[model samples]
Target: MDLLEKKIYIAGHKGMVGSAIWRHLQARGADNLIGSYSNDLDLRDQQSVSDFFERERPDIVINAAAKVGGILANDSFPFEFLMDNLRIQNNLINSSLDQNVERFLFLGSSCVYPKKADQPIKEEYLLTGPLEETNESYAIAKIAGIRACEAIFKNKKKMYTSIMPSNLYGAFDNFDLNSSHVLPAMIRKFHDSKINGNQPVKLWGTGSPLREFLYVDDLADAAIFILDKNSHHPLINVGTGHDIEINKLAKMVQSVVGHEGEIFWDTNKPDGTHRKVMDISKITGMGWEPKVSLIQGITQTYKWYLQNINSLKMVNMYI
Candidate 1:
């Protein structure tokens, strides 16, 4: 199948991951990409989503829409994070199946794995143990999505693929201190402090948790590469297979932002997972490797944050 000629629908095209995928597709001369803002279409509305699928009849669908946030945001709105993501992905998957979409790409997060899963997490380790309490709701929703896609592919012989990516940060990332993820939140906090007389930045937890981050654009490239190669694994993990401690990551962001502030760790706040990195051997063996290094990705993200500081908006999940 010639992907460039296919009508592809990318849900959540305005957000960080979706926007990166859209940009990558455009750069690769894919001109038939389709997306709509929340105002135009509410994915949670089953009738609306069914109608849209019927009307557009896209050849392929990429499920990238979700209600995402850090620990505090997830804890504060667990119901919304769980229900909204469930609704959005369920609607898209059902509608795509009903429309007989040729191929479906469902994007998931590394959090789908168990919180205490073995380090350098592998795809087979999913659901082996409990999830981090803070983001359990969001993780359950994503797990449902992955299972849905897997069932569809196994039973209906459809080409539905789910890609689970590690912590992603890049342009268009949410910098809102309230709901943003660790990387962008760090970037925003450091930058803000640097401008505000380099006030001491207070970070959550003990700064002892370990995390692995992948550049959003690299995730975009991996998704397309998987599709192009016709690798129809039920679920594939994409990451750099590297990890870093929170304290070190914060120090890196501080250096990148040139913030001359003392770092303080708040033990009261939850640290969430202690360490969550991906075992990317599957994707790497499939000939897809992450391109951007952590420091380089952080620098680029900080640069984008600075360039769009004046026009940045609070990134909220679409219902």
Candidate 2:
């Protein structure tokens, strides 16, 4: 079905990727894009989620929200990462299917690939080996979401597609050094170090792991591409098909942020996976390619960080 002006509900519309999708749809003249904050909709509750699906009855759905955090948060809250993500995804997928949504898209992560998968991983590399222990719980839940979408696509020939995006960062990213992803974490570290008299920044691991990163807006563009194309892939990898080492990433962030401070790596921390590149040929074959290069994306993100230094920082709420 043509998705122009379709009632589309993006579950995690406030996030980096979801927000980008929302803006993209706005520019595309889709005036009916709808989203609700988790506080209002509590997607983790099955009955509530099912009721919302029935009530909204959106023509299209994009599952982009999850309990995303860094290695420290994941290691500390494995149960929350696993159970919350499971509940949120299961409720959304089940309710959307029940409501007979015309097209559904589930956003997965590259961490679903095996920890030791081949460089430039492919869609077929999922579950090929052990997952990285740091984010295994979150990764497993995402894997379940992908499997659910695949099952629906297989059984009903539905337009249920799952996209595994590489590590994403952008304007609305979490920059909390303790709980944010690597890119945002590095940004915060460099920013703080620069602001506080250019103190040397201490980073985790040996900075040897090779990783892939995609800009969140580019990911949103790909989501729109898939939605507009009425895509039917069980799983497709979305990335720039490139990779960089952690040390190199740090240097790039430092350069972009104008931080002249030295970077000190604490090798005591685990480097996690050695490499996690994506074989984005599947999505490329589908005519969607990432437009933003890493350097360009990082510079844009740093500009955003400079613009919203006070707001983008995540503050943990205590009860």
Candidate 3:
């Protein structure tokens, strides 16, 4: 089914990735798209999700809602990351299958792979090793979601696809220092450092670990690509297929925000993994690649930060 006029439901419509997907779909002339905030619908309840499916009966489902957080948040709240995420995905996927929804796109993170998995991580190396201790719970939940989609596809040839996106940053990103991911947290930190007379910014770890990031818009476009092509692969990695050191990333964020602050690395903080770079051959082979460069994506995020400074301030209230 074409995106146009198809009833599409974005589970976490208010979040960075979900909001980007909704906007991309609308921009592409997709009508009949639907979404609900947390207040209107609690995804953790089984009956609530079942009733939502009965009422909305959406044609496509994008399972983007989850209790996502940074390493610190995940380490602090393991149960919430595991239980809440499992509840949400289980309810949504099961409900979608019961309704025989034409397509279901479940969004998983790159962290689902084992911590010591081969560099340039491949989808096939999913359970080859151990997960990063800091975020294992969240990763486990996402792995389950990926496997569920794989099961649906292998057993019934259904259009249940999973996309394991690399680090994403763009509009609607949670900027709270406690819960936000590395990119957004860096943006927030640099912005504040500049405002506070360019105070030295203290970052975690020894700044030697490497990581990759993808623009949320590029991810949104990939979602459209998957929906258009109805790719049947169980899982595909979504990323730039490149990486940068944490120190270099800090410098980039500092340059973007015009912060002249001295960088401080506290070696006392644990560097969860040495490096994680995704092999994009699977998705690139499918003829889809990210367009936005890392610097451009960061610039875009900083601009959004400028415009929504007030909301950025209030974001901390949630933590």
Clashes of each: 0, 0, 0
Off by over 4 Å in 3: 317-319
Candidate 1 local lDDT, 117-183, one digit each (tens): 9888989998899888898899999999999999998999988989999999999998887788999
Worst 10 residues of 2 by lDDT: 310-319
Ranking by TM-score: 3, 1, 2
RMSD of 2: 1.8
Q: Which stretches of candidate 2 lie over 4 Å from their true place?
A: 313-319
The local distance difference test score of model 3 is 0.91
**Could you tell me how far off, in angstroms, the CA of residue 313 lies in candidate 1 after the best superposition?**
5.7
Query: Using Cα atoms with residue i matched to residue i, what is each candidate's TM-score against the true structure?
Result: 0.97, 0.97, 0.98
Pairs with steric clashes in candidate 1: none
**Could you say which candidate leads in TM-score?**
3
**Candidate with better TM-score, 2 vs 3:** 3
